[model samples]
Target: MKTNKLILIFCLIFSVHSFAQPKMEEKKEQIRALKVGFITNELKLTADEATKFWPLYNAYDDKQFELRHQKMKAFKGRMEADLDKMSEKEAAALLAQMESNEDELYQIRKKFVTSLKGILPSVKIIKLKKAEDDFNKKLLEQYRNKGPRR
Candidate 1:
């Protein structure tokens, strides 16, 4: 039918326009790739250190990602709730969940630091922290320089 054809045309245009936008997932992967290279260079990782470091680093990242994904799924709707209209019970629950997530995030970082201690020198680990902070700062700066998307 003509209506069906019109609908298909609309979908095609919409898909094309949406595709032009910078996707968040792609941006994240790009940053992640850059971080790998940045950290490798910053640490001046030798073959031996890189070999031992990457596997442990990857495991820690995976755990952290899992925890974050879990929190997103659990709190996605709750996070967007209106504060003033939210019941005390709902607010308390959301706060408790947020607190729990923060605690878990901190614990994972502590565990990651402990694991890194076995693989990297303390100096390299310190450099790694600085490198991470620098990478984030640079990423933020780039976003700011780009200004808001229309």
Candidate 2:
């Protein structure tokens, strides 16, 4: 009987999550649109430059997404448990793994920058980085203004 109750609860959770997926996707699309608009206006991309720039930019974005997802999956269990209660060895190992992941992300950024060199001028590339930082800061401010989410 307890097992049956547990199964029912699991099913309910899954159904609720599935129902929320469409709205989650809509939010992602909205954010992507906002980001593109912000980048376009901030960078002052020429029509010809935009045409050549977007595909390469998308690849860089995808690499960031891939690296983030990889790190999340790799550290999935590490986040759920209380870190303060963990053994010294466990914490040390976690720190090592985190550092390694950060190094990998840094290398990925370096490679992406190298790939962007011939296609994009240094000024535009710097502008892109600045635009990204500004966009992120604005998003954070908006979220803060909205207060804590449930």
Candidate 3:
């Protein structure tokens, strides 16, 4: 009887996890749609400009996301370790990894902006940066205001 109960509980938990995965993906898609709309409005991109711009922007965004995901994965592992007990060499290595990640991110941004110059005006590129910042701030504010999740 106990074995059956354990198996039933496991199946229930697994089913709920499977269901939740789709919801999480749906949420990501919603946010991506919102970001696309926000950026399109802010840039006021001409149809021709948008045709050229989106491909470049999407590529850059993907690269940035990939790098950030890698960095976060590594950081998460380090975080699980006992920080106070970490050796000096490990601490130094962590700092070096962080600085290298920051530098790589900066280089990526520089390359992206340089590429943008061909498709967009300098002023519009500057506006794009500000628009990105504004969008992030607004999203964060909304998330904070939403209160605790279940």
C-alpha lDDT values of all predictions: 0.77, 0.74, 0.79
- Give candidate 2's total backbone clashes: 0
* Tens digit per residue, CA lDDT, model 1, 57-82: 87888888888987768898776767
**lDDT tens digits by residue: candidate 3, 1-150:** 343344445544554344345477666655655666677777787778889998999899889988999776988799789999999999999988988998999999999999999999998999899989997897787668865468
Give the clash count for each candidate. 0, 0, 0
**101: Cα error in model 3, Å:** 0.7
Report the candidate with higher TM-score, 1 versus 2. Answer: 1
lDDT for position 65 in model 1 = 86
**Per-residue lDDT for 1-150 in model 2, tens only?**
343344445544554444345577665655665667677777777677778777887787887878788776878788679978999999889889888888988888888778778777899889989999998998788668866546
Summing lDDT over every window of 10 consecutive residues in candidate 3, give the lowest-scoring window: 11-20
Q: What value does the lDDT take at residue 84 in candidate 2?
A: 81
Cα shift from native, residue 49, model 2 (Å): 1.8
**Rank by lDDT, descending?**
3, 1, 2
Q: Quick one: best TM-score, which candidate?
A: 3
